[model samples]
Target: MDQPTRQRRGLLIVLSSPSGAGKSTIARMLLESDKDVTMSVSATTRPKRPGEVDDLDYHFVDDAGFDAMIDEGDFVEWAPVFGYRYGTPKAPVKDALREGRDILFDIDWQGTQQLEAAMGEDLVSIFILPPSMNELEHRLRSRGTDSDEVIADRMSRAASEISHWPEYEYVLVNRDMDQCVAQVRAIVAAERLKRTRRIGLVTFVRDLIGPAH
Candidate 1:
């Protein structure tokens, strides 16, 4: 087989950080490098920017559609942010898990909490932080995309977000982008080796013990 053929144990891998903290970048790099893993496409009421495609960057929806999905209990996790609502749809992620593929989530801490509540042990959560406040501010300012007002708002929120670091299973300080990617990759690799996540290994191990010996 080209890849692991046994049934894929579904995993809900979450990477949460405040805006400009590089969670999205790390998530994308992980998806690009791992064949068995994929990004969870989120449903959103936020308007798509130029060159964004449906079911790629997001499953763009209107407020009514989003409400309908919520009413139907179709979201694993969802939240409103900056005047728009975004959510992870339940069905596709469930299907992906059944296929032995892992799903990656780049969302906020609140969404992480909801996902953990919905899926429990299947979720692997990581919290990423900037090396320092100065570095964080530098990253936010370097973009030159946010206005002074928006940047201040993001910084204010970052403080509260960082306060929740202890809530995650892992904490990664993204001082160097490459190092941060490596750290996240290591976390995924370690999680995949977890005994509970590899139930199939039990049978294989028992076989090695032999029937009569």
Candidate 2:
């Protein structure tokens, strides 16, 4: 069987938030629902969590390996957060974009900045915040992955992260998980309909005009 032609003109979605602000959850759902979209796997210096496979949850690498890629200009964006380094590779994302498949990023604000600088107009940025500070604290504590001290530190850092909401094109209050996911899906749908991303649509329009009489 012949393979289908790759898509053209994809979206670059930047979904950013504090450690426990639900950006990751929404990103996962978006990926699940949309065949045209996929996550931009990040390269991290941190060790893989249990059952985490490379190139899935993250691409775990050694310092020297990551640094070598950095020196080679292999990352579209990179940042050092909480003692661990993380970066978005330059190639896969670009290739996905060229093939007309949208890529979602679950990075923090700093990484989003680098992506914006790199992808420019191709980027669609969103910031997610908890319903309130109390709720955020609660969510962080409930995760059970980090200790009290770590959770406290994360909550403290969250304030700074949430302050950057105005910078995002879309701000979502993750009060209700399903609703927020729907809202995000709607945004993606609208973005996909954007004229600039529809090269074929331009040709379709010209055809509609019937050779300019």
Candidate 3:
């Protein structure tokens, strides 16, 4: 008979980049193509934007609700961004890792630090960089989603975010979208094969070698 499939622990994959550096695009492509991974929906105290579905986009909650969750120690990591609070609920992340299902996080450096402190070896972080600062500014303008003032603010924030690139396990220069996505996928594939993640590897290898006789 064929042997049962070996179980493995999941990864907490973090993708962080400066605004308009293509991490969001890469993340969407990955989620569409990768079946073993899923996005981690965060709980936020901010109001949902138009067409944003609750629990799908974000679990919107009031300040009081967020405070309650904090008091109960329900979050694995939480942070404040733009005067709003966002947190990764502890229960779902814990469950996913135990089930050998990966979770993706699209957050900034501060949030990544919190997760790294909480998850250590279970986390694999990637920082995406723009080819050039000029090119980064160009992409922000091309999006047409923000005013010049807002774009300038984002550019300043981008510099700060890029300074933290050394914190990640992998760094990719996103000169080409398709190539970057491919490289990130390769990272995921390799990380999944890590000995620590493969919880059943020892037994599987033992079975292959046959009982010590």
TM-score of each: 0.93, 0.93, 0.95
Candidate that scores best on TM-score:
3
lDDT measured at residue 124 in model 2 versus the true structure, 0 to 100:
91
With a 3 Å backbone cut-off (N, CA, C), the pairs that clash in candidate 1 are 8-100
lDDT score, candidate 1: 0.87
Regions more than 4 Å wrong, model 3: 1-6, 211-213
C-alpha lDDT score of every prediction, in listed order:
0.87, 0.87, 0.92
- Per residue, candidate 2 scores C-alpha lDDT tens digits across 1-213 of 111212248899989888887988888888889887888889999998889998888989999999999999999999999999999999998898888889998888899888989897889998998888898888888888889999889988998988888889999889999999999999988887777777676556566667784
Model 2, which residues run further than 4 Å from truth?
A: 1-8
Q: Give the alpha carbon lDDT tens digit for every residue of 10-113 in model 3.
A: 99999999999999899999999999999999999998999999999999999999999999999988888868999999999999999999999988888899
Stretches off by above 4 angstroms in model 1 are 1-8, 211-213
Per-residue lDDT of 1-213 in model 1, one digit per residue for the tens? Answer: 313324347788999998888898888888888877888899999999999998888999999999999999999999988899999999987787666679989889889989989888889999999888888888899999999999999999999999999989999999888899898889888887777877576566667677665
Query: Candidate 3, residue 83: CA error in Å?
Result: 2.5
User: RMSD of each candidate?
Assistant: 2.2, 3.0, 1.5
